[model samples]
Target: MMISALPPGLPHPPQETERLKSAAEQLETSFLAQMLKSAGVGEMPEGFGGGIGEEQFASFLRREQAREMAQVGGIGLAQSLFEAMRERHDV
Candidate 1:
């Protein structure tokens, strides 16, 4: 006999629903962060810059900005992702 993790015909609990939503939002944030990084949104100046520490933390700034954007329903990608995932998993 095999033990199933989700089992059949059982809907996910509220925490699981929240997890799916969070996952979708995270994906959107990650995509936006990458785009911002590629666009040099946080790039330091050639001179008179914050130097190495700023370089290390620049990505964090982009990520937080991206998270804020996603929270504001950025590009509507997160909502679409959440719906698709919920439907696919029969949640």
Candidate 2:
């Protein structure tokens, strides 16, 4: 009599739901952090240019939001940024 072999189950992989939840959590955290930073609720180290005020914090938040939006979904923001910078300096 011949017997069939069962597949190995040693490699446990995360479920799709788990992965989605983790990704959502990360995005939420990033969004909140960006919001707080822009609102000036966070701290700024010494000798870091201007002081951490409402205006500065708000500006930071805006930039962060834009960056995050551009970053998600594999849009290649990093590559685009690099190309932009490279265009400025040909050397």
Candidate 3:
């Protein structure tokens, strides 16, 4: 049988590929969280339930929500990022 040669620095090990995928997802999650925070999704008007405490913890909520969204196939950003990295690294 003939063996095919991989391009230099391309095609990481399975574990490394998994790590890259996780990192891409995390990056996407962070981006989504920032977008959600900027859109004021977790904000509340004055005299409502939101206050200093809520503001302080709003980021955490946004991050969790973003993570869930990414896990559930969010905005295709993660996939795009993963594919780009794979191509760049020749993986």
Q: Report the poorest 10 consecutive residues by lDDT, candidate 2.
A: 3-12
Q: Which regions of candidate 2 are displaced past 4 Å?
A: 1-14, 44-91
- Which runs in model 3 stand beyond 4 Å of their true positions? 1-11
lDDT, candidate 2, 1-91, per-residue tens = 4322224433223453344344454455455556656666545555565654755775666666645654563344344444443333332
Q: What value of lDDT does candidate 2 attain over all alpha carbons?
A: 0.48
Clashing pairs in 1: none
Q: Candidate 1 at residue 72, lDDT?
A: 97
Residues 1-91 of candidate 1: C-alpha lDDT, one tens digit per residue: 4322465467778887898899999999999999999999989778868978998799889999999999999889999999898777763
Alpha-carbon RMSD, each predicted model? 3.6, 15.2, 6.1
Q: lDDT of candidate 1 vs native?
A: 0.87
| Models sorted by TM-score, best on top | 3, 1, 2
Which candidate leads in lDDT?
Answer: 1
Instruction: Score candidate 2 by TM-score against the native.
Output: 0.33
What lDDT score belongs to each candidate, Candidate 1 first? 0.87, 0.48, 0.84
